[model samples]
Target: MSEKNERQLRIVGFLCNWCSYGGADTAGVCRFKQPPLLRIIRIPCTGRMDPLFVVKALAQGADGVLVSGCHPKDCHYAVGNFYARRRLELVKRFLPFVGLDPRRFHYTWVSASEGQRWQEVVTEFSAVIQELGPNPGIGADTPMETAGQAASAFA
Candidate 1:
């Protein structure tokens, strides 16, 4: 493979242990060929997700972030995913304000039994990240004014 093809995008997946993570495991057992981009972090529940986690991942050079959990009203912890949905939505919207591409972050729900759905979600999100390319990263050297100007231009 050419260097370009060999270079996999750095994607981070924060998966809820009860559902989405199991779905990913099921996809693996089924031998689904997902893009080898994501580095999965299994969290106890979607409620445990912190917006700073996504921000830190992007700031540290992750190309994209994906947060998957149990379907709404289907959370193993009852309403964990509900809280996740709200927080993740806020983070997704706020990313652009900080000069990051909002498209670089995505969140969804998947159940443990839905192996095929897990494969589809990862494939689709990976393709989207590939299209967006690598994250430019938030730099410390750039003055706040310049960064704000750049953010506006990006908008």
Candidate 2:
């Protein structure tokens, strides 16, 4: 592996802006250390996440994916987190159909005030990804080899 790839695991985080994202920001501002592997993408709400996008990231060679949003009863947008929970659960159950391990994907809740919880969440998830290592991908090409190209396509 190249030095760059060796330096960071390909872990993607799709965080809801109103809650999880803020929580992460708080972690940073508070100087609570987090793993360097997690690359964050702030979304309006987890309810807006498309299952396909999570699959696509894994297919493109991401070692792990984390989707976090507001707590169930505390979503800024009412039932938004509920919708996200349902979709993410369905996707988690069927990861094997796409040749990905269910363990590679995770979803959870963290409010804006939960900076310490955010640190714990990221640390735990990053360890899981490190244990899993690289994904060889479903097809002939390996994810590590094609991830750069595929990641750019989506970014």
Candidate 3:
């Protein structure tokens, strides 16, 4: 296979520090085998997640984006996860509208104590991403004007 075809696709993960990040860490420390595709970004809380972050990631060549945070009503910030749920849902809906596959994005909740759950989540999400293969990030030939227009709509 050509080197380009053999390269791994990028999977970006936005994890809440108090819960999902810790859960992921625990999974690592416990030596659970999981896909190494994900690159994690630890956020203070899910409520802090901006929909644009997902858009930018997709536009910047992320094959898939996984957002994991504290379980509803179990968030350390009380209602942060709730807000994240609302925002992420809307983002999911908007994905297809932007000429991007909605399946490339996923959001879920995982608690800090759920290392096994974290392992399962990553494994499942990674499998789906691999199936989808690499993303071109809006296509290399797309005019800058159109890209800016799409981004500005979200702004």
Count clashing residue pairs per candidate. 0, 0, 0
Q: Candidate 2 lDDT, tens digit per residue, 60-83?
A: 778889999999989988999999
**What are the lDDT figures for the candidates, one per model?**
0.86, 0.83, 0.88
Off by over 4 Å in 3: 1-5, 139-147
Q: Arrange candidates, best TM-score first.
A: 3, 1, 2
Candidate 2 Cα misplacement greater than 4 A, ranges: 1-7, 139-155
Over the stretch 1-155, how does candidate 3's per-residue lDDT look in tens digits? 54444778788999999999999999999999998999999999989988899999998889999999999999999999999999999888877666778889999999898999999999998888887778766634566677668767877
TM-score versus the correct structure, for each prediction:
0.86, 0.84, 0.91
> In terms of lDDT, which candidate is strongest?
3
